[model samples]
Target: MENIIKVKNLTFEYTSDEHTHRAIDDFNLNINEGEFVAIIGHNGSGKSTLSKNLNAILIPTQGDIVIDGMNTKEEKYLWDIRQTAGMVFQNPDNQIVATIVEEDVAFGCENLGVEPLEIRERVDSALKNVGMYELRERPPHLLSGGQKQRVAIAGIIAMRPKCIIFDEATAMLDPSGRQEVMNTIKRLNKEYNITVLMITHFMEEAVEADRVIVMEKGKKILEGKPREVFSHIDELKKIGLDVPYMTELSQLLNKDGIKIRTDILTVDEMVGELCQLK
Candidate 1:
């Protein structure tokens, strides 16, 4: 797989009157094209800061980040870089600018000078892609949390970004709302073949990813397949992160000689394990 994004010795810090706060240090990473990657860490672990720097929302104090061969620091390519790697933030209300859902979805393409007909087609296609086409004409403020987030995603999709970076976009949503957003992202990757870089606190969400990157105190402490990474139950706990619920249950069952796979993630997997035991 080709590399869609790369970070080399990335470091970022903020200067305060008392002292400098290191947000990221010597962090290096590579994301393959069309891969669904979940970045999990506790707040202030540098994941947020790193996501910002990916498309030049924040510049690194040291090191370089390149997206599709263009350096993020290049002033001329900033908009191009962002178009290639679109970002969806947490607040759905703040992201919905236009009153109508369809218009808001078309907003990005409008700014990009897409032809009117092309913009309309893009809007409809994007809404359909996120299963929000049914309510395309509805007012965004009236939508549910999950619906609003889906609208936000449709808006990004209209921009035709090769990769989408979601920065805790589902954090404030309820479980069902979170599942709605997660399913949208997973489908976008599995069906549409878009690269996904999701920064999330949800361990269950990470389990569906092609790979998981664990961050701690401004650095990359662990990176591996979901099964491989979640297997480090002790390390994850030490970093103030939780293992997936099924993984935890599987671990306890194993300890009690119930004999279950330690890497179990989904509810269906747990159900299968229990049935087999019976």
Candidate 2:
């Protein structure tokens, strides 16, 4: 797969009179085209900061970040990088600018100067993609948390970005709402082939990813397939991160000398392991 994003020796710092706070320190990463990667970390782990830099919302202090071969630091590539890697923030209210759902979805395309006719098509298609087309005329503020988030995603899709960086997009949503958003994300990656870089605190949400990256103190501490990374129950716990529930159950079974696989990440996998004992 082609590399859609590359981060080399990246460092980001916030300086004040009191002291300098480094949000990202010497972080290095690469994301392949059409890949679904979830990043997990506790507060102040630099995950959110890294996502901001990917879309050129925050410029790097020392290193370079290239998205789709466009360096984020270059002034000329700013809009291009942002267009290529759209962002969906934690709060849907913050992302929704227009009063109506369809208008909100078209906002990004309008900013891009897309033709009115094309914008209409994009808005309809994007809304349908996120399953929000039926409520096109509804006011955003009246929608449920999940519905609002879907509208926010449609807005990003209208921009036609190759990748979407979701910085805790589901954090404020209820479980049902989170599932709705997660399903939309999966469809976007699997059907539309959009690369997905999700920065989230939910361990269950991360389990569906193709790969998981663990961050701590502004550095990459672990990166691997979901099963492989979640297998490190102890290491993740040490950093105040939790593994998927199934993985935890498998680990407990192993600790009790039951001797099952430690990498089980889903309920189906646990059932399979238990059945294998017969």
Candidate 3:
């Protein structure tokens, strides 16, 4: 796998009134191309801070961020770095530019000096990718939360970035809205082979990720497949994280001597296991 993003000895801090708060400490990570990575953490756990650093929105006070082998700290490569790794913040309203959804989606390529004629094609293709082509001409303000977020994502896709970093993008959405956004991201990863780094607070939401990276108090605490990481229910619970609902039920069943698997990540899996009871 090609390494798209690398963080070596990355450390960050925030200072107010000369009092420094360590946000990240010697955090190091390597993210591969076309991998669906879910970053889970509680509030103020430096996950958001780490997401920002992925594309140079926030540079490490120490160490460096290399995106596609380009140093994010290099002023000359700032635009290129961003072009390679696009970012989607939480709010749809903050990301949108044009009144019409299609035009907003074209904003990125247009800024990159992509030919006007080609921008239209990219915008249309991107909207179609996210299942938003039908709403391309609709006013962004008139769309639902999920629609708005998809348009925001289409805007990033129009940039044709190699990687997309989402920072708690579903936090403000309803369950359906969250599902919509998550589905779109997953589709992009699977269908288009786009690298996805999503910061999330919902443990259940990450069950489908190719890998899950758990963060706690400015450090990388756990990293593995969803089943492997979530199976450590005790360690996760100790860090203020919840297991998948199905896994929680599986744990209870096991405790009751039902002999169930703790690695169950979905309702269907739990049901299948119960049906196999002898």
Query: TM-scores across all candidates?
Result: 0.98, 0.97, 0.98
Q: What are the per-residue Cα lDDT tens digits for candidate 2 across 39-95?
A: 999999999999999999899999999999999999999988989999999999999
Q: What lDDT does candidate 1 reach at residue 52?
A: 97
Q: How does candidate 3 score on lDDT?
A: 0.91
- Winner by lDDT: 2
C-alpha lDDT of all candidate models, in order: 0.94, 0.95, 0.91
- Residue-wise C-alpha lDDT for candidate 1, range 102-185, written one tens digit per residue: 999999999999999999999999999999999999999899999999999999999999999999999999999999999999
| Candidate 1 residue pairs that clash | none
Compute the lDDT for candidate 1: 0.94
**Cα distance off (Å), candidate 3, residue 220:** 0.7
Query: For every model in order, what is the number of clashing pairs?
Result: 0, 0, 0
Worst 10 residues of 2 by lDDT: 225-234
Per-residue lDDT of candidate 3, residues 1-278 (tens digit): 89999999999998899699999999989989999899998888899999888878887899988999999888899899999999998999999988899989988898899999999899989999999999888999999988899999999999999999999898889999999999999899999899999999887778989999999999999999999999888998898889899999998988999998878999899889989998
